[model samples]
Target: MVEADASWRDESLGARVRVALWLRDEVGEGGVFSKASMREAIKGTEQVDRRMRDLRPAGWAILTYRDKPSLQPDQLYLEKIGLPVWRAEHRAAGLRQISAKTRRYVYERDGHMCRRCGISAAEQYADEPGTHARLTLGHVNPHISGGGANAEDLITECARCNETVKHLTGVQMTKEQVWDRMKELPVQGKRQLLAWVKTDFRPLSPAEKVWGMYRQLPAAVREGLEDDLEALMRS
Candidate 1:
């Protein structure tokens, strides 16, 4: 039995714990609730829905409209609760630990850029000017039973793409919208994109690979390199 003091009202609890408690206390099993209501109840909890979704890996059966056609778009059904993450023993449940060696190897292998969107570390999104892309490791095949921490099993991805792909929600652009942009590409560009699509991987050009390395240099060194490159070009 859960303790009486394990209340969702306690602001001190981690957001994940509070979300679990809120579902346990407020919305019992087989209950349906809206994202808005949960967000309202758990004010100040950043990405409350994401915290709730995090429970899924722990065997929490949270059914979204995509999973259950009968549910309204904004509604979610708690089919069953899995682990009691609030408990000390199960606190780290469902979280995978990647070794430092594996992390470094994967990032370097992928050219320190997100394999999904081809965005490098600290590069801002074209659509969202002020927001910079953050890189993270994601499973190459997320639907598989066990997503191991091996280098082959992992791929560098921007944080936005990581969440979106894991959730099976397509990127913000519609297929038609993307196709329209693709149609505008020159013939050579189209051929290059087609090759990338066929392989499901974008091969960085020599210049792009060098640019990724350049982006990692210190500010002073980078400025000096810029001047050297310009002088060499003029010679």
Candidate 2:
């Protein structure tokens, strides 16, 4: 993945070409171009949006809010041109999806620290407030395990804590067992784990895990699970 703010350029024609070259290098021919995907690839939303706009009618790309790629070039062109420049500017200005907002909110709610390993956002953001940080927004209950995307279902954790929890609890424990083990963790760890009780955290096993936990539910319940989780994960 490209590092955030990899470069700073004056948003000019030459700058746009350079950005396109960077995209060509990073994404290659098979890669699909979209606002979100390019934002991720280039690591600068403003840069990507500006480059896209400046190159418009020439190098057009399209993506759904869900991040899915659109194959129709005409639709892509239409959508890109239809959007107001200011809206794209706002998106490039750091206004992220609902999920990103939720993730940051969860991190702040947890005192801007990793509840599992005790890593703080202060330490992660020491050099730059918005720079990449060691702390991650972890799902207290993973989506694969039937977790929702609600504030009550997530927490801030260091990479270590997030990975450890996933590895330790993913397939080895039952939902109840996972809860039991959570009680034995540190205070922060417990705080992280407790966030999942209100949401479903099904274990990864039989296909029923997905079908039953998600599909078989009532429409409202299923919609809640689906929509909320999507919002939280920014998926």
lDDT of 1 by residue, 171-197 (tens): 567889999999999999999989989
Backbone Cα, N, C clashes tallied per candidate: 0, 2
TM-score of each: 0.68, 0.28
Give the alpha carbon lDDT tens digit for every residue of 1-235 in model 2. Answer: 2223333332332344445454545544445444565555555345566455344323234232223334543222223322222322422321112387787677556665566645443243344555433566666654232245678767777655664554342354477996777778999867655665455331233543344234324557767887888999995
**What stretches of model 2 exceed 4 Å from their correct place?**
1-98, 122-133, 143-146, 170-235
CA-lDDT, candidates in order: 0.82, 0.48
TM-score of 2: 0.28
TM-score between candidate 1 and the true structure = 0.68
| Model 1: per-residue Cα lDDT at residue 104 | 86
Please identify model 1 stretches exceeding 4 Å from their true place: 1-5, 9-14, 30-50, 63-77, 143-146, 169-201, 215-235
